[model samples]
Target: MNEQVIVTGASGFVGRCIVKALLVRGVGVRLLVRDPARAAALFPARGVELVEIEDLFTASVETLQTALAGGGMLVHAAWYAEPGQYLDSTRNLVCLTGSLHLAEAFVAAGGRRFVGVGSCAEYDPTPGHLGIHTPLRPQTLYGACKASTYQVLEQLLPGAGVEFAWCRPFYLYGEGEDPRRLVAYLHARLAAGLPVDLGSGEQVRDYLDVERAGEMIAEVALGGRCGAFNICSGRGQSVRQIAERVADGYGRRDLLRFGARPDNPQDPPCIIGVLEET
Candidate 1:
């Protein structure tokens, strides 16, 4: 692993895992975070240098260049939480809706490898998708943002020469995730010996453990190329099935409660996406 690296969203679920993985590989990290106190709390190692200040939304290219100078790779994992920031559709309609400006700044500063985190939602829901070979069917605002960002990167290629690889994680779960997240929420509920609430639980989706995602991202950051791939188990599991598995693992079968949670408006008619071939 290269020592000079910058990781945005160091406080996020996937970002934290990536940071930890980089540290494990003996890489020197420059973690970019918006909140200083949050950075201090998350960075357990004495080796990391936290850059807590303005972000892609606020930082100038010159300021970002100073911070990003000489980094071998830039792992772009930060974004605004949708629905609260702008209407989902509006966010996607614009180019560079996310930290794409940050990507430009990274390129300006001579960074090489650019590994980005995206969503499986980038694909349309109508088709029975399987792997990376399908046409994009982005059905939501966030998905459209990600899809457009990839297009932007592609358009900048040839001259840019920035080695870019994007990973569309189908579903991810781990400790320290937001309480509102389904998996972590279930983890907490199961830990507390309470029934987990999942509406219908009929939706079939893929879930990737954050640890595996971290490793894959690290692999791409080092020397990966410009392409998109789905980083998933390639195995579809129903919501109820996962709950049952988690309960079985935790020996809390008696506390499995079934119910409904508010579904996203753009919730695909079904949950499925083409991912990287395993």
Candidate 2:
């Protein structure tokens, strides 16, 4: 009779919002956090509990599975954008293994309805010859790892009696996010009255608010059908457009600048995912 839920990456921007949504709906949330102190002390409501992972990025599947046995739903939001992996092909397997373990163990314990967050980067740059669902030919390490996880989960979970729901979120802008990220950084710089040095600004990205995405994810976890859903504003925004919006919102239009640094080769150019088949 325990209506409990477990979430990975609970201390992160989107993870926190998902936890909050569950809590607001009167569901007990068990957050798998690396460091509880790093989170806001007031994050947990009367029914919320924070379960710290003693060995992050190293815990066994059995360990995490047992942790999830008491949950009604699980959301895998934990990702390693860390530089230690160097985005190498071999390291991608390690990250993918950890991601799968969460789902595997959760299923082993009779819990299904696993929600995994995917990125727009997983889509093919052009559908010309490939069309849609084209094997996810990723360029960067992060994209490769995400792609790897998606395929394996789909193939393996069917045998385990677990259903998977993937949510491909577009560019999300919000507070308490890392400053190095594009939207968060631009918001901070514009708020600080500093010149926003941006690239060509032609790179259009699908943007969604973190809070809104969280609500959608919660709904999917409960009643969403199988397969992936594109969780975005269903619209795209360029870099310059985002800068201008932030400037206008913060009233700092004069601080916008262009042509800052050369774009990274790994950075996707105009990465916008189209979500079809609602």
Candidate 3:
């Protein structure tokens, strides 16, 4: 844990958690961020270094290499994840390209280990339960881009003598979650004593808190594990069940109104991850 690890998007939701987990484990961290002041305010802990990049998705490989120097490992958690619009945004393509550039820089900088964050969307959701062996059939631009990065880096990084791992997270909630996300929205509404609308609430998903997900990703980065790993709760819960559970926290289960909002026809009916390890 003493080795220095460079983390991109250190100011982001998942990224910030990952940085915190690493620091808690006594690992030195170097944050690659667009805003150094913001990152510094987020992590007022010792042994944290912030390296600013004007735009990670547009930074030159040489610039990234210089910024990545001295860090033996990297946890890449940055992406254009602007809630509602990110699913089909062209920014996914930019992120894909920039991630490749960052990988190139990592290799050039003599980095030994590279851990990238991915989403469960990289798999075909029709299967309901996803495992490491599941065939990838990403249905959206964001999933495609993530799957593409995994495929390319799976072959590219190892060939370049750099160890690599990909952490694919399922439905993540908890601290730092965007208000537009399901869990956050439910809390905002329920805490305010307002009615929370939802769809049929039948779709099943695997939910994991972002803090646990971050610890798992940090484990992957610090350990010798390679290839893809699922960061999930390993259990399924219906949307209704999750909503009710959140509502129960505020003693406002009656405020939850299922079927109030039309369900997105494109949403998969179920998505549960099969954890490969403890």
Best by lDDT: 3
**Per-residue lDDT of 239 in model 1:** 84
Candidate 2 has an lDDT of: 0.73
Ranking of all candidate structures by their lDDT, best first: 3, 1, 2
Model 3 agreement with the true structure over 170-192: per-residue lDDT tens digits: 99999999999999999999999
Report, for every candidate in turn, its global Cα lDDT versus the true structure: 0.73, 0.73, 0.93
Across 208-271, the per-residue lDDT of candidate 1 in tens digits comes to 8988887778766765466876777777788888888888889987776665465555554456
**Compared with the true structure, what per-residue lDDT tens digits does model 2 show for residues 121-164?**
56675542221365577766677778778888888776677888
- Candidate RMSDs in Å, in order, are 3.0, 3.0, 1.0
Query: Rank by TM-score, descending?
Result: 3, 2, 1
Candidate 2 off by > 4 Å: 39-42, 82-93, 127-135, 263-269
TM-score for each prediction? 0.86, 0.87, 0.98
TM-score of the candidate numbered 2?
0.87
Model 3 spans with C-alpha error above 4 angstroms: none
Question: Residue 262 in model 3: shift from native, Å?
Answer: 1.5
